[model samples]
Target: MGVTEYSAKKLYAHLGFANGRDTMVAEGYRMDVLHVWGTHELSTADLLEWLGEFSPQSVEWIDDSSCTLRCNIIMINESTVLHVLHKLAEPFDRRVALTAMAAVISTMNTHNNGGDFERALRPPKLSPVEGTSDRLMPPCGRWFKSISSPERALCLYLRIAHKG
Candidate 1:
């Protein structure tokens, strides 16, 4: 198995989830595992760079040196396996602007809605690590996966997981 596949297996194993190919079954709900893995070390600059490469619009740093990140909205299932850990116990209020959640009206437009990137955002809940719990469910009822890369410097896990 490739790194991504291995990571997926590890993740499912961590969650005690059963899987077939790209799909994972948890709590009677089937979810597609959109897993990605790499050896990139965790670093604020590198994290921003990767975010810039993937989702750039809502990237904000609470402290660039500290590598704190804030996103407006995300609909992709991001995950990696590594060491350093940082998680948000709670999410921002819907009344709060600047970073609204993205909605999944259709698969194609999951990343954007009506040209607005931030709407109906549901961020990920904190997980001690993989396999320690069932799939982390954000407010939107979608699966959210957050994993660190092999480097332990950066993690691929993002916000908002979508089911195709």
Candidate 2:
């Protein structure tokens, strides 16, 4: 589908979109196509550095504003998602990882035919949570360590709304 056609579809309603602007205060083009928000302490530079770790062909930074970042991320399969999750877990908290996963999954599911995300997060055996037979719970604690800091946490609001 064309970029405009893809953007027309309401792929992610959960991720809030700010019409006519990318960031909260920025007064430029309308870039709020896909918004991913989570608690994080990383700045724009740090985020760009993290993105650079991935393959150059996979991630293309179209816009890198002071308060906003627009990139075209190409996730080929579940392995890509896992790699992203691993990278996110390295520096950020569980919440941040979860948010990124959700955004990636949602975006993938929206464009793809079947639900690839279901298989990605599904546990091999039965869920360990009580009163739940087969809950879709991400293996957070087991997969990665949950670390929190005493200092104030910043919200990492990443909007993937722009197409170009």
Error of 1 at 12 (Å): 2.9
Worst 10-residue lDDT window, candidate 1: 80-89
Per-model lDDT: 0.32, 0.37
Which stretches of model 1 miss by more than 4 angstroms? 1-3, 20-22, 25-50, 56-164
Positional deviation of residue 16's Cα in model 1 after best superposition, in angstroms: 3.4
Error of 1 at 121 (Å): 37
Model 1 Cα lDDT, one tens digit per residue, 14-114: 43345632444334321312222211334444554554433322323322222223322221223311111113111222233223322234532554543
| Pairs in steric clash, model 2 | 33-161, 34-161
Candidate 2: Cα lDDT at 92: 30
If scored against the real structure, what TM-score would every candidate get? 0.23, 0.23
